[model samples]
Target: MLGVTSVDLADRRELLDRLEQYYDAVPRSGARVEDFGPLSLFIREGQGWPFYVRPTLGWSGSVSAADVNRVRVRQRELDIPESFEWVAETAPALRAAVEQAGLAVHEHPLMVLGPDVPAPAVPEPADGVVVRTVGPDDLVLPSALAVPHLAFAEPGTGGGAAGLAELGEVVRGRAGDGSVKRAVARILAGLTCVAAAVEDNTAVLGGCAEDASTSGRRIAGARPVAW
Candidate 1:
């Protein structure tokens, strides 16, 4: 039964891999290859986060205990200072390798959306706020909500600049493709400021906001997502 279950799991993994490839091929800024391998790293640059890391395949290559030193060494070279995301199967060896490398691990429930599901009714903006759909050009808002956008992972988990740049490149590519949308909703002191890009219908991409305070300084969320 264990062997049968393993085979079944492998088969499902293969299917998901293929689907991920198709999604990654989509001409959107956030389209990503959500699979496992050393070369399969996704770094979101400037925002300070590791976008995604999939499990390792035996043949393509796995992130092992031996790779720990290399991963850390490269991280320093890139100047990345935050934790990043990494996924592992129920493999003790793999998990042990990650932990032994001083990388923390967290379990996240995987959620799937069925095709037959209907879209929820769009919510009306609260009083003193508005929502609008915006293209890439409209991503230039400065607000307080933008601070936590890229806080997905702790820094330094992946190697430094190279890793972050790679992730940023993916995001830039998506943004250039016009697949990324910005929804800006703001409320000022005792008043509604503006609401833009109210609805994000798909999970394929994420969004970010730039924040501007009275001090004339600007800060943005570390990561971008539609939610």
Candidate 2:
């Protein structure tokens, strides 16, 4: 049993690494990469604000007053195009910076899953629901996979469409690159549930779950889905 668990974890890790690589490769429009020696940053132009990602840290960036003002100025300089969002890990330095800058701080917990754990019990489909695995050739699959958790999310705090698209790109890229082997999709009553499994034959490294319900439906009694 212990050996089986180890193999599961390994598989999860491999999938996660591949997903990270995919995100690193696909650049977003107006997205900029900043290298801070110990960290790398991905910044994108958003609808109302700029979106940011720190794949290395596994956390989203909070806005500082400085960041807030800087972004505002940039928007004007860039002709105030569209809404934007930013992301980063909640490190001490980052937290302090955002706080000192007078930007409100929002917290999002990072979750992970491993192979020793049992597979998520298949969810019951709602009326008129259909579930299917998204194939690699389906370009729309990536966009669909990228939808964020909106029902359990706070207002102005969820990763909207662009964020979801980014996520989908990562999942597809990793799976295609031999970093992941198994990915699943569940759609019930016109809503969707997606899970990405990354593991070797033995252990699971990590997994992520997304509830894609148009009516903001959620999976009740569902365990933490791996990512």
Candidate 3:
């Protein structure tokens, strides 16, 4: 594993640029876009939430409250949650615009592993456990997908109340949902990757990288690394 080190401005800017490019490609695959000068508003072709506003590609300046509101109004008109997403470090000025739009801004720590280094070795799974990447069509895919739902279903971190029965129920509940199809489409397009930590043929834990853009210069991280 790589050690922690102070990152310079060039490193930060390069990472942000790659991230911006990666995200910009994602919506184009399945969403409609409305570019508003300094920002681009993404609206999903079908559902919501994944849709958001981000700084326009190669746009130099920051957005204003008016710019933020333009996207917000479109969101409201379309009856979707008004959402904006971006790296705080990359677009410091956008925060004020978001706040001025009467929206609460929440910050989540970005854990970006520097990609220009050698890839770390994959660690062994727990004893008797197997860790490997899986395709969307795998039999246990639904269960793997269920992990997040079950995990968030329980509030605190005092271990879970659920088990195999609950997991099976989750899988069965959404039988006809288009999740499998969507997963297949995305994965087949080289846009998504899913990992499973399986023991006794069940997915006890899962991880995923969706809509990844590995083109251009290699700042290189695997499904495990990168932002």
Candidate 4:
């Protein structure tokens, strides 16, 4: 059995609000959300990524099979994969419905740091390693795609070029609106890359291993907006 604390209710509401605002900030170019009662159907048109947003529901409220079918019909209409993200603690009914539809369920950990927690320390980079901020214009999408692809390259798989090319197309598509630049800058500020190198102000790195928070709550360009 799962235990619920008094704080859980407050946290759930806050999380939902944050998620809604984050999706709202998504560019108007290819982003749209179709509200389905408590579920927000998020579609990034042409990107082939559609996500269902499920809010915390009361135990008395159970997800119906109709809800599952609705999602299926919509995905079929869009010709996109079926996917939804919801809090495990609050989505028992929806979980069962999706599983019954034979779709694989994936659960991911949600992490949040409070002001009281001490900020994590950034490790010293190895010798000859240099880390610097590179603007969007300074780096090509191919080089950005290479960072993760090269880092995760296997011994003899040998599909790096093709995979990188496909990813480059997607990256360039996203970069056109400059949203990718803002997002990456926001990410790298909080997460320090350990094996990163700056050549001509462009970065190629291994992995991020640090939280980008300070003692205060400021993150990169903007302060956390209250909802």
Candidate 5:
């Protein structure tokens, strides 16, 4: 769960709008854009799942079953998995419209921390573990990324079978799928930030942390747009 307590709805709505605008404007690596009136489909070029179907930036009219049907038909034509994403509060009608189109609608709780919210204090890493922000050029980035896979796979402080070789294999596999390159592009383009925890000269665990609000209007040269 994300931050929900003591939230101001107006401020949160502004941030959500910002996020939606940013996502619509920014380039998603390994995906191509296909627009259909109120919806924009992010189709995967190769590898991985299709991105998603989302309301276009600045879309405000109520979404209807016919609207959902058009996008679904296009997705089926393209052979991509059917998926729709939006904020329930902002898109109250979309849920019903999607369900009416015979696609399952799932609600995901969202936590929006506006610029007004003070960041939480940084916690100390475990002894022998160092937590730090990872730069795009950092040699340990792949290992930093692999830590999350290891962390969830085993769910413990110990490294277990999830070590450099195993993690390296994971990284190599991502490279083949262009995930590594795309992730690096995102970091370099200021679209996201990465943090890592290192142990034994390796990011053994607690790595692959993403910093939100790393993009959108904050990015250099991007036109200012409300989310």
Candidate 6:
């Protein structure tokens, strides 16, 4: 039977693979990933505690105690905290391994919106509220910034401010069509607004990459990788 998330075990593996590849392509400032047989270790320097180890397909089976120890060893080597993503439906074994390693488990919603899905219209806000996108050139402006970090904070913690900016910089640098800046500018211009068509750029909204893996090249959502 399928799990609470609706994705069956077999399909979940495929989806996980795409998500992994998608994350691999993203440009993180000081984060490095190391493959260790059953899982991949992501060690990020600075911006608070680091170290996150995860298996691409946790449903494959229970990980050996030795494998879990490897993750701890790497965390100690980097002097960082221990954390990783455990899918509700497919990570039973990974979850067991981590729990055995004496780490707490937390859950967060992993949402996905496909291209074929129609986007809802932007809502109207109360009086005195304004909204719009942050223009490409205005990315450096202090007033125009500050939304990203809080929006994309770590799951349990407050926020990843440095990581947000670094990711923004990477998106900006890689932006060839000026869509990234335009999207930001639009969001900033009005407190309630939606960028209808953003092409070839990175978009941050609702605290995550809204355009991930889209043909429009917006934020690159799961569709590109999942299908």
Q: Ten-residue segment with the worst summed lDDT in candidate 6? A: 191-200
Residue 108 in model 4: lDDT: 64
Query: What does the lDDT come to for candidate 3?
Result: 0.74
What is residue 77's positional error in candidate 3, in angstroms?
A: 3.0
Summarize candidate 6's per-residue lDDT along 150-203 as a digit string, tens digits: 444444444444444565564455446443444455345432133211212333
TM-score of 3: 0.78
Taking the tens digit of each residue's C-alpha lDDT, what string does model 5 give over 1-227? 26665456666677677767656654454578887777888888755335788887778777788888888898889988888888776677788888888888766567654457897896787799877777887776776665566555664445466557877677776665665566687688666566667777666553332233434345322221100
Give me the runs in candidate 5 sitting further than 4 Å from their true place: 1-13, 27-30, 45-49, 147-169, 204-216, 219-227
28-124 per-residue lDDT for model 1 (tens digits): 2232332334424344433223344433333354557556545455556655442434334323355666787787777765444434778569776
lDDT of each structure? Answer: 0.39, 0.39, 0.74, 0.50, 0.66, 0.50
Ranking under TM-score, best-scoring first?
3, 5, 4, 6, 1, 2
Judged by whole-model lDDT over C-alpha atoms, candidate 1 comes out at 0.39
For model 5, state the Cα shift of residue 83 in Å.
Answer: 1.4
| RMSD in Å for all candidates | 14.2, 14.6, 4.8, 8.5, 7.0, 10.1
Error of 5 at 212 (Å): 11
Candidate 4 per-residue C-alpha lDDT over 1-227 given as tens digits, one digit per residue, 9 for 90 to 100 = 16977698787676654543443343222447665654556676443224554442323466766677676788789876666767664455777777877778877666666557897996876566565443334453234434554444444434344443444454555555554454355355543223235444334442332232333332322211100
Q: How does candidate 4 score on lDDT?
A: 0.50
TM-score of 6: 0.54
Taking all chains together, each candidate's TM-score versus the true structure is: 0.46, 0.38, 0.78, 0.55, 0.70, 0.54
Better of 1 and 2 by TM-score: 1
Per-residue accuracy of model 2 over 54-145 as CA lDDT, tens digit each: 33435445434465455445545656432322233224455465566555666665444444678679876544433444444433343333
- Which pairs clash in model 5? 17-227, 18-227
Question: Which sections of candidate 1 miss by over 4 Å?
Answer: 1-15, 18-62, 82-84, 89-93, 139-227
